[model samples]
Target: MKRIVIIGGGPAGYEAALVAAQLRADVTVIEADGAGGACVLSDCVPSKTFIASSEVVTGYRDTEEFGIHSDGLEAVTVDATAVHERVKRLALAQSADVHSKLVKAGVTFVAGTARLGEDTLGHTHRVVVSPHGSDSEYAIEASIVLIATGATPRVLASAVPDGERVLTWRQVYDLPELPQRLIVIGSGVTGAEFASAYLAMGVPVTLVSSRDRVMPHEDPDAATAIEQVFRARGMTILNNSRAEAVTRVGDGVEVRLSDGRTVTGSHALIAVGSVPNTDGLGLTEYGVTVADSGFVPVDRVSRTNVPGIYAAGDCTGVLPLASVAAMQGRIAMWHALGEAVVPLRLRTVAANVFTDPELATVGVSQNEVDDGRVPARQVMLPLAGNARAKMADLHDGFVKLFCRPASGQIIGGVVVAPRASELIMPITVAVENHMTVSQLAHTITIYPSLSGSIAEAARQLMWHDEE
Candidate 1:
């Protein structure tokens, strides 16, 4: 039987190990940070758990419009301690569940960090495994090696994370109490989502963006809508402002900007970006190509230049998403086992930013069309006209579709609304199946539903293009 060693027990490593075990291979996973990596134990799962609470608060705040009223009731106070406890417990529970699954699949779980070394059979890899807090290293042999090591929040010396007054994305969950005022630096997805979440939780928030607007990566209209909503909620927004450094003030924190502007807040959350965890992994010695930003270079099949060595997840730098990592893992296993496998097709993947009015997108964008890469026409439908949005008081979102000008084939789409991730599936399906906008327009969506707006947008696009 073939022996396989997978490093980093994130979604990629765990899922790949499961597939290898099913194929009757002896599989072992070496993970230093336990199961689920940052996605479950720290980033995605725990953060979403807190966001779920924000959804409840938002629902309660908007309940009065539905003719429901508590005569003298006020906004329910948030217990940060309780929230932290639940977040940690749920993360632990999910991690335990993953561990159980690995056991059931007969995959060996090694609690350690793994580095690739010499190959035993030109195909067999020697892995140096060092357990956390231990000086000893164990060498293991594997016919195939997969690297699923993920990324970490980038830290700058000017604004180091003290895990107290200044915090990284993961450390914020450990806060004992809500900050009197929280200043978030960076207006990207991570920054915007956290700012929106805290604002929804009734915390005073100031979003500092160096760009001209928030969510600069998203659609212009979508970004505008989010900015308007954040402003309307009494959240302070500072744009065209770059933080020079974050220093601890007497009892709070002060962020000094490059333009001689200073802002004070009880706490500061850094969301600039993430650095791929690639160092000290022995990749350089093995001639593994790395990108300028230090991400491992791999082919679509997740194979490195060296034979029998594979890399996946954030380390590959394809897309820093848990779902993408899981898929890459499975694809690596399939290709390794000589089974039919398809290369990673990022254009068909759907991604979402889970803020109040979520922003989700799939495939290409209009910007690509304007760049003369993809010839496409666009159509957008405002949610304000949708009956469902009217009932739900959702007036600040839209669905936009991009399609081939002549073929009418759906190429990509973006949906900005509540649960936009779930709503984006139809567009994902259309893009994957090459369904035309006219065909999508014919599909029946329930009346008085936000989903209807999606179809309507496609219909409007079809009409305008007359394709």
Candidate 2:
């Protein structure tokens, strides 16, 4: 029987364990953190759960738009303690769930950090597992070794996370109370999401973005819409400003910008990005090629340059998303087990920023089309015209689709609205399955639905093609 040792228990490691076990391999997963790694235990699950609470607060604040009386009602207030408790509870529950799934799939779980052992270059490799807070270690022999150790929030000496006044994304939950004001120093997905989330929770937020706009990687129009929404909600956004350092003030924090200005807030969140957890992994010692950026260099099949070894997830730096990590892990196992496997295709992968009025996208981007790299026709339908969006008071989003100019094949799409994550799926399906604009346009959609805007966009594209 093939023996597979996976290091890390995030989406990549756990998902791969299930697959390898199903293939009748003896699978062992070594996880230094909880069963679901930082993603479920500290990062993705906890953060999203906290964000969901903030969304509920936002919904209550918007109740007046639906003619619901806010007068003579108990004022809604956030209990940071309660919110953090629930967040941690749900995260632990999910971690337990992940562990149960792996066990049911006949995969062994090792609670420890793992590294490549000597003779790792051989056909069969050795994995050294060192349990936390222990000097004792053990070795597991494996025909295939998969590294998915993931990454950590990047910390700068000038802006260290004190877990109270100054914070990293991970330390936000540790805060005892809501800050009088929050200064988020990074406008990428992490920074923007937190800024939006805190603002929704009735916290004054100042987003310090080094770039010209928030979410520079997202669809430009979507970014503009969200940024506008942020400004409208009284959130201050300082663009083209880099934070040089963050220092403690009197019971608050002060951020020093490179432009010789200072901004003060009760708390500061450093969302500068993440660093891959690649050090001390013994990858280079075993002859596996790792980039200077600390990410493992992998082919589409998730294989490293060295045979009998593979890497996946954030450690590979393909895309910093849980879904992408899971897919990469599954692909690694399939390829390792000698089963028919398709190489990872990132183009069809859907991504979402979990902010209020979430932005989601898939496949070809409008930037590529505008730059003439992709010859595609584009159509956009404003949600304001959609009956459901109007009923729901959603006037700030649109559905945009792109199709091949000649073939009318759906190539890409973007949806910006409440739960855009859910609405982007149909477009993702069309793009992944190579469905045409006509096919998607003709698909019946329920009336008075935000998703109907997607069908409308497709219809407009088809009409243009017909003309």
Candidate 3:
């Protein structure tokens, strides 16, 4: 059997390990953190779990339309401690499940740090591992090596996280209680999600954005819709404001902006971005080229510049979504083991921002179509027009579809609504399969469903103005 050694136990790394084992290769995974890596332990799982709790409370808003009133109950309140209890519980359980799967798949799981280089015996195709909780080290010889070490949240020198008043996205769960007024710096996906979650849970929030709008990287219309909701629900959005420093003052924290202004809050969350966890991995020594930004650049097959060295997940600087990372991992294994491989199609990748009214998209974006990148006919239908949306008393968000003018082939789509993440799947499938708008329109969706808006948009897509 061809031997494969994978570094990191994240979705990318563990997924690769499972694929390698299925291919009948001897596989080993070395991870210093838990089996689920930072994604499950701190980043994706915990945050989403916390958001799920917040979303429940968000539904309580405007319930009077459904004959529900606050007079029936004392008040709807969130217990930060209880929410975090569930967060940590689910996170740990997920880690354990991933660990069990790796073991069941016959992949050796090693709790240690891995360095790519010659072993003690001077074997160039060997990895030196410093086992966790032990002083001794060992070496493993593998015919192929994969690096899925993921990334770490980037920390600013001027604004350090105290794990209390001032915190990073990863440090927020450890907070004993909710902040009186939470200030979220950076209006990207992470910042927007946290701000929306907290606001929905009745926590006063201030969003500090360096850009002119929240989620500048996302669709403009989508961002505008979210900003409107945030404002309507009493969120203080400071667009075009850059945080220069975040320092604790008394029991709270203060953010000093670039323009000599300060915003104070009980806690400050720095959601700027993250850097690839490439240090101490000896990537360069093993002939793997890393980018200046510390990311390991890889192609669609997840192969680095050097043969037999594949990188995936956040470390590759591809899309930072967890689903994309898992796909990259499977592609890497298939290519490495000589299986019939289909290259990763980035265009069909679905991305979602988990907020109050989630924003989900796939394929081409509005910017691309408007900028003459992807010429297509488009239609956008408001959720207010949907029967189910009216039943739920939901008025925000829309379903948009884009199709080629000549052939009516669906090229892209966007869904802005509650459970938009789930609603985008059909469009993602339509785009992935190169289905035409007619094909999608002919399909039946439930009468009282938000997803029916997708079908409605598809029916009207080909007749709309071409970009």
Candidate 4:
């Protein structure tokens, strides 16, 4: 039986270990922290739970427009403490669920630091083991090893996370009370989502972005819509502003920008980026090549240069998403177990940023086509024109489709609407199956639903204005 060892208990590692165990391989998973990784305990689950609370409050605010509310607006009070309590409870419950699965699958669970041990085949094939508690360090001989150590929030030299005044995304859950003036730095997906959520919760928000607009990696039109909505909600958005330092003042925090401007807030959240947890793994000693950013270099099959050693998830420098990580882990095990498996394909990958009105996309982006990499024509249908969007009181959103100019083959698409993250699945399927724009246009989507706009966008592309 092949002994397969997985490092880190994130979705990637746990999922891979389960697969290896089911294949009858002796699988062992070594994780320093608890199972479920940061995705569940800190990042994805916790944040989404908080957003759910904020979304409920936002619905109440919209009741006046629907003529469904009469009075009691002055008596409404937000109980952030209660919301946070539920978030923590849900996160812990899910982590326990993951722990149960690993045990039932017959995978050995070890809690401690893991590293490379004895190596063979020119330091390619190696032993991976770790020390647990005070007991003597145990060693596990692995015919194959999978590294799925995920990432942590990136820290700036200018502003360190204090878990109080200055906070990281991980520490935001520990806040005792909502900040009267919350300042969020970085305009990426994490930043925008939190800022939007807090604003919906009735907290005054100030978004500090070094770029010209928020969600710079997304479609420009979508970004503009988000910015407009934020401004309309009384959010103070500071663009082209770079934060130089963050210091805690009396009862709050102050942020100083490079332009010699200073802004004070009750709290500051640094949603900059993430750094892969790759240090001290003894990777180089095992002939594993690492990138400049300390990420392990792996092929499409999740194989490292070192034989019998593989890496997946954020550690492999792949797209940083829980869904992608799970897929990568399965692919790695399939290849390592000598089963038929296809290489990883980024072209068919779908990603979503869970901001208000969301932003979801699959396959290629318009920027790629503009750079002449993928030849395609595009068409956009505004949500304002959709009957469902009108019924749902949505005025700002759109569905844009990219297709081959002559053949009308759907290459990629973007959707910006409420729960666009869930709505993008059909577009992902269309891209994966290589469906045409006309095919999407013909697909029956329920009327008076936001998904219908996807079909309408394809219809617009089918009957384009000729030159």
Most accurate candidate by TM-score: 2
Candidate 1 lDDT: 0.89
List per-prediction Cα lDDT, in the order shown.
Answer: 0.89, 0.93, 0.90, 0.87
Clash pairs for candidate 1? none
Better of 1 and 3 by lDDT: 3
Model 1, TM vs. native: 0.96
- The residue-by-residue lDDT of candidate 1 on 241-304, one tens digit each, is 9999999998899999999989999999999989999998998887777778989888899998
Best by lDDT: 2
Q: What tens digits encode model 2's per-residue C-alpha lDDT throughout 1-467?
A: 99999999999999999999999999999998889999999899998898999988887666787889774123778899999999999999999999999999999898889999887445799988898888998898899999999999999899988898999999988888998999999999999999999999889999999989999988999999999999999999999999999999989999999999999999999999999999998999989999999999899999999888999999999999999999999999999999999899999999999988899999999789999999999988888999998888888999999999999999999999999999999999999999999999999999978889999899999999889
**Candidate 3 global TM-score:** 0.97
Per-residue lDDT of model 3, residues 61-121, tens digit only: 7767789776422278778889999999999999999999999999999998998875334
Q: lDDT of model 2 at residue 381?
A: 86
TM-scores of all candidate predictions against the true structure: 0.96, 0.98, 0.97, 0.96
Q: Native-vs-model 4 lDDT?
A: 0.87
lDDT tens digits, residue span 1-467, model 4: 98888988898999998888889999988887777877888889999999988887777666667778745334456787898899999998888899899999999888877888867544234545555665566667678889989998999998998998899988877888888899999999999999999988888999999999998988888898889989998899999999999999998999999999999999999999899998888898767898899888888888899788889888887888898888889899999999899898999998887778788999889889999999999988889998988877889889888999898889999898889989999999999999988888889989778988888888888887233
Root mean square deviation (Cα) for candidate 3: 1.9
Clashing pairs in 4: none
Better of 1 and 4 by TM-score: 1
